[model samples]
Target: MAARERLADDPSITFPGFFDDTAVQTDADGGVVELTGALLRAVEVAADDFLGPQDANTLCVDRHESHRYRVVRRQGIIFIRIDEDPRACGLTVPALHSGAQYAIGSDGRILRRLRDGEPDGSLAPTDAGSGIPVPTSEVGRSFEAPDGAVPLPF
Candidate 1:
């Protein structure tokens, strides 16, 4: 039966808290517990498992204040990208990354990193579309960033 098959495939899952170097207060006696480096790393590993396979196309987090962050997987990997106005100093940039280990900055700058044993600057952006993936503001028309900004290819 389809239901039987689904149940068979589903496995038990556990979730680890994702708070590194974060302090926790104990209700009893107002005790404070601080997560150190090792504990933090362990938490990260455990959190990864709970978050599901890295190959998952999407990962979302919703908070109490209606603040939500969605980490979408493009191919496999995900990077924390920070983007902001190039001229702004105190910028509240969003961290968005594709599975390619690359990021898009709020300032419209693209960030890429090379893997181990490889040259850092050797990475190149092949034109997935007709041309490069930069937004254009010509003819004085309303516009948004180029489609390249999206994780999914157009």
Candidate 2:
């Protein structure tokens, strides 16, 4: 039962070859082959089946060297989320969404077009823990011009 739960949430075990663009094909063996519509449908079906309804919560370890992953299944559709860094570009800025929110299928695939449970933008930036503005230190500038230098008259 645990294995079944992992299969639905873990991308690696859930989808063979992670359903790479040119990974699976039929009508040819041991050689490069063109992807066909039938092959694609097969993969989709495999995913949908493996991700069937599961227990309250499923824990799956990512084999792709990705961050820790968790799944929340509802109505047979699982939402895959990762423990991601909240900062972007390593900048000390507040983003508009939470890092661990994504709409995913029970098959360990993300629903690119779907936005499930909008992220919490209320998260404060790490740099500004208390939401207090931090001021940049101002360095004194050299106001003295070059010795014997004169200003040009316009």
What RMSD, rounded to one decimal, does every model reach?
A: 20.1, 17.0
lDDT of 2 by residue, 130-150 (tens): 675545553454457557577
> Per-residue lDDT tens digits of candidate 1, residues 1-154?
2211211111111111223334333334867756445333332332332233344344323111112212222332222211222223332542342111222222222223222233334335566777655546554664676676667554
Candidate number achieving the greatest lDDT relative to the actual structure: 2
Error of 2 at 138 (Å): 27
lDDT of 1: 0.30
Error of 2 at 27 (Å): 38
TM-score for each of the candidates:
0.18, 0.22
Q: What is the lDDT of residue 79 in candidate 1?
A: 27
| Residue pairs in candidate 2 whose N, alpha carbon or C atoms collide under 3 angstroms | none
Backbone clashes, candidate 2: 0
- Report the number of the highest-TM-score candidate: 2
Off by over 4 Å in 2: 1-63, 85-98, 106-109, 112-154
Worst 10 residues of 1 by lDDT: 6-15
